[model samples]
Target chain A: MYKKSRARYFFLMPGVVWILAFTFFPLIFSLYLSFTNANMRNFTQATWNLVGFQNYASIGSDLRVGETVVTSLYLTVGSTLLTLTLGTFLAWLFNHDLPGLRIFRSILTMPLFAAPIALGFMGLILFNETSGSINSIIRGLGGTGVRWMTDSWSARTAVLLLDTWQWSPFVFVIILAAMQSIPEELYEAARLDTGSGWAVFRSITFPLIAPALGTVALLRLVETFKILDIPFSMLGGGPGSATQTYSYYVYITGLRNFNMGYASALAYILVIIAIIISTVYFWRVRARFE
Target chain B: MATLKKEAVMQPVRAVQIGRSPLARILLWVAVLMAVIWVLYPFVWAVITSFKTQREALEPTIVPFLQFQPSAENWSAELGLGARETTLALGNSIAISIGATVLATVLGTLTGYALARFRYGIGNRNIVSWVLSQRFLPPVATLIPFFLVLQRLQMIDTVPGLILVNTTFTLPFAILIMRDFFADFPDEIEEAALVDGANPLQIFLRVALPLATPAITAAAIICFAFAWNEYLFASVIAPKDAKPYTFLVASTSTVRGVHFGYLATRMLIAITLPVVLSLFVQRYIVRGLSLGAVKG
Candidate 1:
């Protein structure tokens, strides 16, 4: 039995080592680097200064930092809600016994598979102020074209809209699968009770799939918070930093500005926020299960 | 007696009537159509934009199709099959993504099987949670340290470096999905194989592996898609020799005097592999997503 236990440890060794060296090690090292004033110009032989809590302090007081955080939070929350609502509605629609339903589901999920950077460029072209297809459609509908990438509000909306368009299909697929798994007998019983369509849904479908919905929502929230590629590639966080998400801000600081230490601090804060939000969401989910 | 007969007659009629209201049918069709347009219009735009000349792309038009003379010059230039530099980048992306997926799948399967079969002293719940949390850590936070570590090891700007970095992100997901799949299998089969006097390795290879082929295939497809789509790490770790097609599409627009048509074509080409892969594995992809998101 002891030998068998030892063999199991041996089986686990390679994966554990890989994670330790790659994942955990880098995580700890980055946490330590957040305190020092590291940058590209003074990268080598740079004396590390232990300015405890100063980096964290600066994050709160800095106006630019605060604005970026608010913008990121807004983008994350707005996109999450939009995708969840829209995706749920689509899932419900496709869930019905309609003809060509499989084909519709497949078509709807195509965007999820497209490369993010490619989709970003596509968004840029489609939402471009003067020459975009969207604007052209608006003009055809007797409204003037909107400045999607140039104006602040519109730019933020563009990012949120693009993200929702791309990711809602993910939620739709998952929720649809969960809906299919529900037992038909439950719905039959509700029907026997002379339940209306709305009541049947409320009493049966919604409760049964709440856990799946919660999981999808939590995953989306976490992903949206870290979104960098689409907004960065599309708007470049331009028109006065209007669309600058936290991840993009970190990119600019670390890579563009070469402020590794401050960027590390920012990254840590982002991680903390992600952990807290996910934890809260998961706690609620756990409560539901119990 | 008349009242009871009336109630009985009304119930079924009401149920049938509620099922297919004209308003409900119209709303459902509208919702489905809207979703289809939302997801597909951009891709259609990319296709149309790819065909237009540079000047045509700049001009606004209400027509749903291309207004200018379509050309293939942009497609040829963007694909880089005619040029050395661009072709090299495309090759590098294909090699790295494929390598990373194969490595991740192999290692993930081994680890997954161990967790499934061994039932080690460490609580199974802890192991599962740890695997899931691996994905929760943002790659940006760990970028700098990974960069420094790779640089010190002299692995940056190499295919191996990109593979190593991608594996960190991909392995956890592969393990999580694969473990769920393995758990769904019956342990009785393995016990029966053991009773036949086969060694552990032989049993896994000859019996369990064949049984888990569908799941393993699904996990592989998911990992491949992820590695192919990954951008930030690929951009930072591979500046020159090891840059992928995604980095190519990103950097092309920034280059001065580059044509928009050519850029659009490049974007289209870059998306081709992933789109094809996704279409091929659409069913498995759905399965994997359900397993990952809807915990049993």
Candidate 2:
């Protein structure tokens, strides 16, 4: 038993070391970088002065920060609501035993596994303003084609639509799992008592699955707030930065403009927001286990 | 009044009958068909676009034979021997994803087993919780530090550099999943091995590890898919020679204009691996996505 207990550290040490070296160290370094004027030009020189919250101070005046935050909120809330609604509806439909239902369910969840950025690139072709299939469909119906990428609101909508398309399946999968976990007897009893499908669902199925749905919703909230790949790939933060997300703006500042210090500051702000959201998520997750 | 109330309560059960009436069934089927189309239309569009010429690709054509003639020009351009960059990027993706998956699986399995089976003096719940929180860290937050660190090590734009980064990002998923699996695993097997004079390490290697193959594979495949689909780190740290297929797919628009046909081909390449692999791990996917908090 002594030998067994000691082996536990043997198992744990390597992962702990790797995390400290890779995850923890980089996070600490980023925190430090946020306080210094660490520009790409100075990086090679290996010299940077400690700026001490100047980077944070500049954030108040930086219009880009405010704009990206607003854009991110829109993308996050819009996509999350759309995905949840579609996913819940699909899950409810899938809960039924129809012929070839497995095949249809598999087909519907395909987008969940596809790379988001790749899908975003495909979104470009699909939502293309001219000679695009979507526009063609609109024109076929005798309505003028919408400018999907050129217009700011339209570009934001394009991003939201693509995000929803990719993630709704994920919500579907999670919600479906939750729905299936409900005992068959519970629904059977509810049906016998109420003699109404909607009543049975409201009294039994919904209450049981609500927690799982909440968890999935919170998960999507955190994920959507970190939306970068789609906007980056699809529009390049385009239509004059209208589609720029918080992460997109941070990437631009840190990597593109080579303003590492300010970028780190922006990143820290995101971290704070993420931490707040994740705390709620962790609380919910813990509530279930406890 | 009481009899009328009783009738009123019973009326909705008949009037609002769900999924039973012929019209309702037809409507349900139509909704299901539309849902499938909504999910699949993008991939269909991309496939069709890949077989198009630049001019044809720019034009909206749903049908290949009727609306336009399908061509293989884009495929040749992307996959031909002359297309060294595209092929090389694809190779990088495979190499880096596999490398990270192998490393993460080993580390995560060991750590997860230890947490699940042993009482480490520190609170195991806290440790597991901390590990779960790592998944929430924004990639952009770590981008600069890793870039600078890798640049100092002179490892920028290298496959190994990317393998290291991808492993870090995906390690949390692996650990949380394996921990959940190991927690649910029966200890009688290990207990029997212990009676036979095998240490925990020996049991983990000879008994537990062998028995846990399915769980391990699920964790590994999930890790591989994440690393495969990764873009930000690949583009930032490994922009030159080590750029993955994801980077290539996203950057398809180049000088002159986007050859829509080529873009479509690359998108197809980037998505095919995960979509195919997803079929194998369908049962475990929700467990993976929810960090094993919700079992599928």
Candidate 3:
């Protein structure tokens, strides 16, 4: 019923123009910077050169780069698994009606909105080997205190635990919302026919919410790959690069080491990986949606 | 079990399990209680630690009066008048978050309205998918280039620069959310408005926008929270003067040492605003967090 008018451009042009100028232009510039020999000390035109493929070539030989990739993958996959399991379990638990459940829901999901950097710092305090509360409780129970910060595997576990603590709520809230959206009559009917909760869930509830679960899971997967703030705040990629994510490494290469070319190259590699995963994500989601 | 069955309409999936044995019910409650403790213990511990002295902080003290004496020393040191950097960082965070939220919301809402209500043919589909694709773009990919561009423009270490960068990342979310809200809105009212001799912009301002207040507010809140929680852009682009509280949350240590009490104080400060704001918009948060995929 709405008329076709040119004035729609009035609404669309400003945002489109802003994104093109800010986001698109910077990305194209970054792609160009990835091939050049640009460092912070001589970032100006006089010293920079458009050296083709040198930065990308060195990526093949750089062992630390490979290690960072493995680290990034491990953290991403591990945290995704941890978050999905905990979040889905919580979602299922919260699906029940109990006294004070609403308040519990609020309290449980609070971590999703809290600043990750601060939460990471909180992890440091909570996971401290000798004096932290977790180890203290463990020791009080007659167990040995863990070396969470100093040990390599323990440090990675610390980072994963902190990330899962913060992000499981994202999965929980999304999955719960999806679960709650299902019609009650379906479960009631299933129960009358089967007279079993597990049968009702498997027949009715699980299939309906599987797509939503997939959406949230893939979202978490892509996001966890860009895990920087947590490890940056908690360990600063310590214990000799135990918890250094790809994004953290990129940040170090670009800003800390001032190697803009190599950093841009590293960043592009991540961009490519993100693109592949998200492409698969979109394909799966769209197929399900269709 | 009969009462739970009666309540099944409200919690269908879970209430179906009411026929379980008493022991199973007890075990279920135990699991729920443990989950609650897992979720809340850190924040509770943080509150406890914030009140302790540095010496008390070193110990695994749980209670305030029994195990350790709580003091306001950390609070005073962190928020006192002498804490110039802390206060400035707080101001910078507030300004930058609000600034970016406002800009992104205004532009995104207008654009979203166009996409939702008007037909730009295949361009609409392309624009929607392209905007969604922008969310997948890693921030690190653009980090160096933004640093360079902002540096050349002399906008580095400035509030406006940080705001611009934050707005860029958050604009896609705002657009998608506003578009979802606008698309779901019934067209009959707008059709009546058009028949009443009103233009599209006039209809939007007088009719549609007021109805969309909750959505616009939700979009703005999510944007503000994201910009407030943002650390990467602010770390690189606004290091010196426009340093945010998120950055300073990590920089609380001095030549003295890493003060757990002091760091806890800053962490609480950094998170309190977003946590409180999320409470007010709890219903709309699901849609926002899920990028409008779930109709929460």
Candidate 4:
């Protein structure tokens, strides 16, 4: 028995070692680095000395300090709400009987599979001149063209469009599965109670899928917060850094500008925000799923 | 009251299918069409643009062959790099993703089996939760640490380094899914195997692995897709070497000049493999994602 147990214990060794060396230790080390002045500007010093909150203090003074936070939050909130709402609606649309629904559903998963960086390439073309496909459609219809990529608001919308396009199918598919798993008897019971579509959905469908939607929303919220590749690739955080996200800023600070200390501080800040949001979610919403 | 309510509920369905009016059904079809278009428009556009000549690509015509003559200049230029860098990048993505998936699956299946079967105390729940929540460690927070660590080990610009990093990213999710898979797997078969005098390792290899094929496929696809599409780490760590397709696609920015045709060609190449694989395994995906807090 003891030898068998030891052999079972060996199963976990590789994953544990990989996680520790790559994730856990690095997390701790970065947390430590957040307190120091170990940036490019100060690496010339003989040895790095901990500055103790100075790095945090200078966060407000950083280039990505104020508007970047707002922009990041705006992007996260917008995309999360957009993805959940649109995904739920689509899921609802397909939940009922429809011919060729399987094929449509599978095709919908296409964007979910397309690389976000590749989607960035598509957006580069789609949001190209106002004469691009979208604007071309508008002009062909005798309407004025909008600046899809150059203007700040339009570029922001373009980013949202790009994200929602790629990911909403993910939420849709999950919600639809959750919807299907809902017992047919419940809908039967609710239908006999009232013919009101709104009431039936509100009472029967919504409550049951709430947990799944909650799970999906939590995932999307965190992911939206980590948005980088598309914004970086599509616009390069351009139109004057209007689209730069917190993660983008962290990369710019740490790797681009070589401001390792400041970037570590920024990363910790983002992690704190993540922790707070997740804590709130687990405290409030997670129990409903259970 | 029940009969009345049934009739009332039937109104929407009847109205939706009123063949005489056709309005509601048309609306439904229109909505479905819009959804289909919303998802597929970009790919269609990319495909069309990839086939267009430079003048046509820039001029932006909707009709492909009708408006301008088609050309393969962009595809040939991008794919026909002196050393075939795009092809190399595609191969790199495949190799790295395969490495990450294989490592993640093996370790994950083993750990998942242990978590599912072995009865441990004190640190079990904590360990499981720690492993599960590791998925939430945003790449931003871990990027530099990984880079510095990899650079120190002189593994920064290699496929093995990517596999090492991506396994960390992919392992937590794979373990969670496989744990769920194993937990939900029928224990009676394993018990019968045990009665047949098969040991744990043999039971796992012979009994468990085959039974979890669908789940293992989902896990494999998830890991492969992740490692294939991963960008930031690739950008920072393997800037010039071990450049995966994602990095290569991002590198072709209009920063020089917007070659829509050229960029679209690269985009199609970068996206085709994973997209096609994902389409086949999408059923498992729906299952894997709904259970695993969703895979990206």
Each prediction's whole-model lDDT (CA)? 0.75, 0.84, 0.83, 0.77
TM-score, candidate 1, is 0.90
**iRMS of each prediction:** 4.7, 4.0, 2.7, 4.5
Error of 3 at B247 (Å): 1.2
lDDT (C-alpha) at residue A140 in model 1: 89
Model 3 C-alpha lDDT per residue in residues A152-187, reported as the tens digit of each score: 889888889988998898888888888888887887
**Chain A in model 4: its TM-score?**
0.90
Candidate 3 global TM-score: 0.94
Residues B185-244 of candidate 1: C-alpha lDDT, one tens digit per residue: 666777887788876777778987887776678778778888888889888889889998
Q: Any runs in candidate 1 off by more than 4 Å, and if so which? A: A1-6, A42-47, A192-196, A277-290, B1-27, B60-66, B283-291
lDDT of 4 by residue, A1-290 (tens): 42246666777777778788878899998898888766555433212469899999887776657877777788888888998999999988887666777788889988887778778778888988644788888888998887877788888888888998888998999888777777778877877898776787799889988978888888788888898988888899988988888888889988887778778888998788777655654444322211
Which 10-residue span in candidate 2 chain A carries the lowest summed lDDT? A281-290
Task: Give the Å error, residue B47, model 2.
Answer: 0.3
Q: Is candidate 2 or candidate 4 better by TM-score?
A: 2
Q: What TM-score fits each model?
A: 0.90, 0.94, 0.94, 0.90
Per-residue CA lDDT of candidate 2, range B48-162, in tens?
A: 9999999998788778899999999989988988999888998999999999999999999988887788876656776776777777788899999999899889999999999
User: How accurate locally is residue A10 in candidate 3, as Cα lDDT from 0 to 100?
Assistant: 83
On a 0 to 1 DockQ scale, where is model 3?
0.56
